[model samples]
Target: MTRIKKDFSLPAVFAGFITFLIGISVSSVLVIQAGQVLGANQAQISSWFWALGLSIGLSGLILSWKFKYPVATSWSTAGLALIIATGSGYNLNEAIGAFLICGIMTAVLGFFGIFQRILEFLPQSLTSAMLAGVLLKFGITLFTVMQDQLIYVLVLISTYFVSKKTLPRHSIVITLLACILLTPLFFEYTATKIHYGMTYPVWIQPEFHWSSILGLAIPLLIINMASQYLPGLAMIRSYGYKPHVNQLVSWTGIAQAIFAPFGAFSTNIAAISAAVSLDEQVHQDPAKRYIAGISCGVFYIFMGIFAATLTGLLLSFPREMITTLAAIALFATIGHNISIAFKEDLDRDAALITFLMSASGVQFLGIGSAFWGLVIGFIIYHLMRIQIKKPI
Candidate 1:
């Protein structure tokens, strides 16, 4: 207890808080879209936020404490995207059942160390390329939003650069502050009346169908693993953190299973927000960075407790602003991954192929582009190697 208390700092707490804000801001829209597609009503949507927040909070707290690392957790954005795209046929109850099955499969993979082995087989360049591809859309969205909201975007960008140069550690926070202050001036502010109390999680009795399992469950599991979890692990590796891969996988899978019935689709290691918490600016002492994760867990609990109002407030933000924030927060990560993706001579072409395929967002069958990108990239890489060795 004393040691834990000693490790705590305001910088760590602020990092965690900012990370949660950025994480929720970036993907809450997608989560809501997915929930709506699954035929969730307003109350169910609130419950979805509640369940996700609680699960991520608890999992991040326990994992960080046990592992003594900033083990940030989040919902799988790609899984949500898949749900939104392919879940039109399935009702909410069926979707919940599929979520349960997906969680179980994920846990099985973790327990058997399958995910870790898969990561071992994957080269760094390929993973980096996939990550870059996944994040490329956000970079594009940032600039596109800038075109319409040029002045606001310019102010935010200027604040970010100035803060980055001066405050360094609080660059994101400073930019966020600028947004909060500038938003009401350009856009009308509507106060959302949130019920100031603990929100209970709503339970939905799951109805499992074989078709749902094959269609929603399997595809969701694959995308979450390939697009979210795989890149998430790669992000941790990129930051030079040696996380317990199997442990994170198993714990997140367990979390998903526990929360699925309440509309939490999938929980996994966070890629972007984890980067924020794992940064040296969060804490100079790497060993004490777990404080940031714990702080994030606490903030998540607060968000869960006021899930309805918080979701409403976040949704009220202008779309352009939200996209801009996401882009700025992710810009560093996108740049880092792209650099690493092309660093190796042997893997350069393969990585580029993966990047283009993923960025193209071309989905085949029911699976997302990220999975296909990896498959195609891997195939091309091996084929090129074979051709190189053959006699001319």
Candidate 2:
């Protein structure tokens, strides 16, 4: 469309690519570990990428294009973590069935508008606090790596600040370039080890079992809904985007259900990686930022097609470098969220509780800190309200 052409920018495209890179490089190992734990071979492992890439790409593309918002979708990293944490008790077939069940459950919840209704009651301050907590890990890792790789991180940070002042629109782009270009100087390049090719899908027959349904499927549904979608929607809202929560939930759920046999265990809103495309560096006008999502979709499909090769190439970089770069990219976003969380005097105490709880990384009954943070904040906020309104 003419509007698409007019809105396109190199910065936004880079933001999308960064999103793709971060999504893959950050937790792809978890995908492989989960696959291996479920007794998958190399081919099945590659298919995980294929299925995940296509589902996320298609869903993100459709949502962003239709809604004119940067609605990026991603495979559930938290779900993969859950699978790995659960050990190898279940076989691949059971995992696939569990995946299908989770998808169906999510779709049903969204179709009935239940998911949207629950999110509607969330306070913006609490949501912002949760998002900040979600992002704080990256910031902490960035500095931790700085202690070990001081010169390297200093260069990247200096580049970010200098470029931010001189070329505000392209600061992250420039910083990322510096990160890549300077990598060889600080670390070794392993290009020769990377193999390139298309990733073919491998389908496994699904079998339902109560053990997996209760142990894996139900827990997966909970983790993804709380850990991924909730914070993801909060991230979108933190940046002032009003996403159609039901459509997002239902479509990704449907996509996951259809592609479960092909190794797509879960697909949901890409919270952290999506933040790469939400910053001002992607686009000056919030209205035009949907281009970043479209670009991210294109990159997702590209990576999906060459799932094996591109994933290896992206992962070739050191983890510290990728994590640090991601943290730098999120600095502005994190700062914005923190300010919003404490902006209202009435919300400050509860928001602080949420932020601290989320950052603490505590988990109970397999759910993560982000979910607990929201719960605690909700309780505190309501308690504060009752206290003020009580008859003395």
Candidate 3:
């Protein structure tokens, strides 16, 4: 009892809540879109949320306690995006098969320490640039939201600015409170009736195909490693935390494989959403920040158990409001990465190219821009260095 009191704090709890809010708001739609693309029924879709929510919650809770750090995990947004983009003509069973293969591949790489070795060659600037580029859209979306709901957004923005100056540590907390209070009054949203029932996982037997394996499984694994794990570790490292990259990747893959039959697509370490709880404002002492992860874990479990009801509740809010909140939560993180990416003059041009490519949302060979951004930036960085070394 005494230990719990010393470890848990309101700020830390709120940070966890904010992390959940940002993660769900930013990416849950993609999950739904992917499910729809794969022709999943409503029950299957709900199961998807349930399985993923449970896996992510358990992973974060256990990892944070074990490592004594705020280690957060999330579904692979890039992988989901891939599904939505190219999930045509594939049955749900085949998609599940691909997911299983991807999970196994990720686990094998992690267990062998092969994944970390691949990341070792990546330059810090490229990683930072890629992160900044990935978050660029959220920041832009916040202001774009202002056009639709000017008063609502203005209120939230005003509260954020005022709280930032007066209550620096709780600025986001205050803004979130204002958002919750104002939402009911301003938005004509019908609250989804809360259903009090445990969600049952719907299991579908997997059937693998060469096309699914080649098209989905391999690409999913690549995105999970490059787009998800790389930036997630970078976020933790930026905050001075030495994450066990191998173990983190291994566990997420194992969890995904265990739950893939129930529609847990791909779970990996969180990059942007994790930053919400990882911030210094969450707590003065970094050692105690694991509370946020635990809190997030609890929330994730609850959300999963009531996946159907909560999914409706989350979707009830206007997209603009969610977008605005996401922008506010990630504002500091995006700025910090941008500064780091451009800090060294030698790496500036390569970093800029990486940032532009990532933010552009381009897809080449069915892979996301973040992976390509790293590749192009690495090449440019070396070429520039080699040219500088040559005698005139």
Candidate 4:
């Protein structure tokens, strides 16, 4: 593909802005939900949102500007599971300690450039399986929603598919149009008031605990590196962009290290949802893709500053609309990850184990099953290899 000259045109920024605006509310809720579960007070929780928003937004803009690529940054989704696993009981101090250690580990991995190299070593099948596991909810959730509103869902699906084939660059627009037209028919909103205002950071001092290493630090560190970092690199590579892995990882860790005490759990590359912003319908050129992410970061910072207003809007938005739109937006990626996970003959069995384990949502002790998904996959793969080689 011929390179498209870098463009920082207003249209480009606006396109990126819209994409970010769409994704910010939903993604921020997930990030905030985790912090809230940890018993982070309002001030601290607000700061978590601010910290993540600022860190991701500013870092994304600066890096994308410097590299002239559509580079985006986000916190680890795996951290969500960790908050569920070790919520409330563990003081904020321990959580900060775990965050500090994990951030250091992530920066170290990036500094040595091992993140990209590990991407090479991971078997294609296992990576695919991991993605399938991550996206299972995306594929299934849409159909469940469709059952209640067949006409609307089908209309949206048809519009999206028809547009994807006929006017690929306009597919998202078609889906979006379908959503707006159908919203009133299916939406159950009795009230709607939008708010936007600035918020302040809430800071806390870090406290170290050796126990948190085994309890929280190791699992979070492992998941962020493997699930979020590795997959994010693969995502960018799959899009045919050469990401600056070392610098990206280094800064991600530094950002988290600085913000953890304020209730930020983990920050790194985003693998799964970055597609929503980077799709050709929104951003046509690989180099210009960073513009979409940069736009998203700015919106995220806006949410950070205007925490009260955005939070209320998010709380008041119609559930069905949000669910239906999210599920539909996620369909293509769900299909892609599923195929990668189970299609290879050599790695199918191990990949299956990984997928099942991760999707099971199992928690043993205080660590989530996602971390075990990697462990179990590697174990089963090597055990089978050893068995195959042994003398009869």
For lDDT, the strongest prediction is 2
The TM-score, computed over Cα atoms with residue i paired to residue i, of candidate 1 is: 0.90
Model 3: how far is 110 from its true place, Å?
A: 0.8
Off by over 4 Å in 2: 388-392
lDDT tens readout by residue for model 4, 55-81: 767776677667766666777665776
Whole-model alpha-carbon lDDT for candidate 4: 0.70
Per-residue lDDT of candidate 1, residues 1-392 (tens digit): 78789998777887787678767876788887898898898788888889999888899989989988888888877777788878899999999999999988988999999889888878888878988897899789878987778888888989888888888777877777788789888776576665566667889999999999999999888878876688778877776777788989998899999999998898888866676677666777888988989888887877777887777677677777777877776777788889989998888889999999888888776566777888888987787677445578
lDDT (tens digit, per residue) of candidate 3 on 1-392: 46557888888888898888777866787888899999899889989999999988898888888887888888888788889988986889999999999889888988999978887787888888989998899898887888877888888888888888888778878888888898778778676677667788899899999999999999888888777888898888777787788998899899888889999898889887888888776777888888898888878888788887787778777776778888887888898889889999999999999999989889887678888888899899888788455578
Best TM-score among the predictions, by candidate number: 2
Name the candidate, 1 or 4, with the larger lDDT value: 1
Cα lDDT listed for each candidate: 0.82, 0.89, 0.85, 0.70
lDDT of 2 at 72: 81
Over 274-322, each residue of candidate 2 has an lDDT whose tens digit, in order, gives: 8888888898899889988998888888888998888887777888888
TM-score of each: 0.90, 0.97, 0.93, 0.82
* Model 4 poorest ten-residue lDDT run: 1-10
Deviation from native of the Cα of residue 160 in model 1, angstroms: 2.3
**What ranking of all candidate models by TM-score puts the best one first?**
2, 3, 1, 4
Which is the winner by lDDT between candidate 1 and candidate 2? 2
Error of 1 at 177 (Å): 2.3
lDDT of 4 at 389: 53
lDDT of 1 at 382: 82
